[model samples]
Target: MDATESTPILLREDLPGGIARLTLNAPGSLNALSDAMLAALAAEFGRLAGAPETRVVILRGAGRAFCAGHDLREMQAARAAPDGGRAAFADLFARCAAVMQAIPALPQPVIAEVHGIATAAGCQLVASCDMALAAGDARFGVNGVNIGLFCSTPMVALTRVVPRKAAFEMLTTGSFIDADRAAGLGLINRAVAPGRLEAETLALARQVADKLSGAVRIGKRLFYDQAQMGLAAAYDHAGAAMVENMLWRDTDEGICAFLEKRAPDWPR
Candidate 1:
């Protein structure tokens, strides 16, 4: 697909190495999640959910920044509403939550390939991914407080991904952390040199691709399920997952290949 010719919100394409890339394409505003952009993202993420060749997925910005958050100008207009009609803002927030949830719910892992500044909703995108890798010195934060607006949707992922105080600090202060610090705070998976960001990310993406496809999909699904359960329920849930996986044909094929001293052909 000529992703460049697609809507100025998001673009999708199959890259080599069984990877899919979803580029946030509103370069003029650091790829901020406009309403149209968020809607497009939901659709493309749905497509990736069913793609057999999509072993892993990457989310990145087109130009200078990953995403600056929801379009503040939209908020400004909402705030300027006559007679305090700001319910539109709630709709906007809900849509942002849906878009963010879609990332983590993907059957295959999603990687945030952040390069430049990622603030507010952009930083939430980083927190919501299965893994986040950034170019060294890249900046990130839920920088809404400084503007007297709250990063509500961002807080959901941020609180889940980072420690409590650390997550709140970013929200309360709206200050940015450099890549290394972001990783240390558990917001980013790792930091690589800017020149080598794509190579490093693709290498990691390829590593994900080399795994059994069915296991990756099923395992990722179960992983999320288990995360939300109580500790005792988690064991019971994993037990069910184990039973389900044990009967799968891939397991039988995997064991057979192991005994035969050859790599098994994993089925998707």
Candidate 2:
């Protein structure tokens, strides 16, 4: 099989400065996370995880909405299966969770550029990223409760980024919140005008990409590793990373450059 077969459900674009943009391409379905799309995402993210040149990743959806969540039509079709879709649903959620976990596990940082509406699993995608930038008018919610499905999967990522009360309200009430409110709740990093969304997102990605790739990678790894540890353990883990980083040749050059009032000659 050709390892690089192109899929219509997803698009990958390489930009300068080691920045990559992954676009969800099924706008007609509101960029829903169908099985095929999830597979495509997993494939691309897997490829990127080992790409030493990629320093940052920006995720966005084509057309109006960022994503409307899972493809209900696809799920409904699986109801005729031997087990009444139980097996299918289980596999779907498992694959989706793997893709979500892959974001933070990647050596590079991932940023979500969102607009229109990001609901249910879609909102979970935003929360899974290292950071998110959304259009001022974009709406977000984990509204599976309205359809009796209950967004239990989405709650995993949502509760991690936002406060418990805020996450519970959105999950239970199936209510949508504006981008500004999402930002204030810590679900998104910032909210900009619709016309400026792409530009602002690229600008942020470029800023991150401009940093020393080695330092950034180490920092990203340490950030997530320490986040789940107790205070003492976290400090111990972070201290080791700091000591290792300080001994790197690039770090020495950076410090010398700073004292000499000149730019560090970092590798591209």
Provide the TM-score for each candidate, comma-separated.
0.93, 0.97
Off by over 4 Å in 2: 1-7
Candidate 1 local accuracy as lDDT? 0.85
- Taking every candidate in turn, the Cα RMSD to the unseen true structure, in Å, is 2.4, 2.7
Top of the candidates by TM-score:
2
Q: Any residue pairs clashing in model 1, and if so which? A: none
lDDT of each: 0.85, 0.94
The clash count for each model shown is 0, 0
State the weakest 10-residue window (summed lDDT) of model 1: 1-10
Q: Residues 134-245, candidate 1, lDDT per residue (tens digit)?
A: 9997999888889897888789899998999988888898888899999998988899999999889888888998888888888888888999999999999899988988
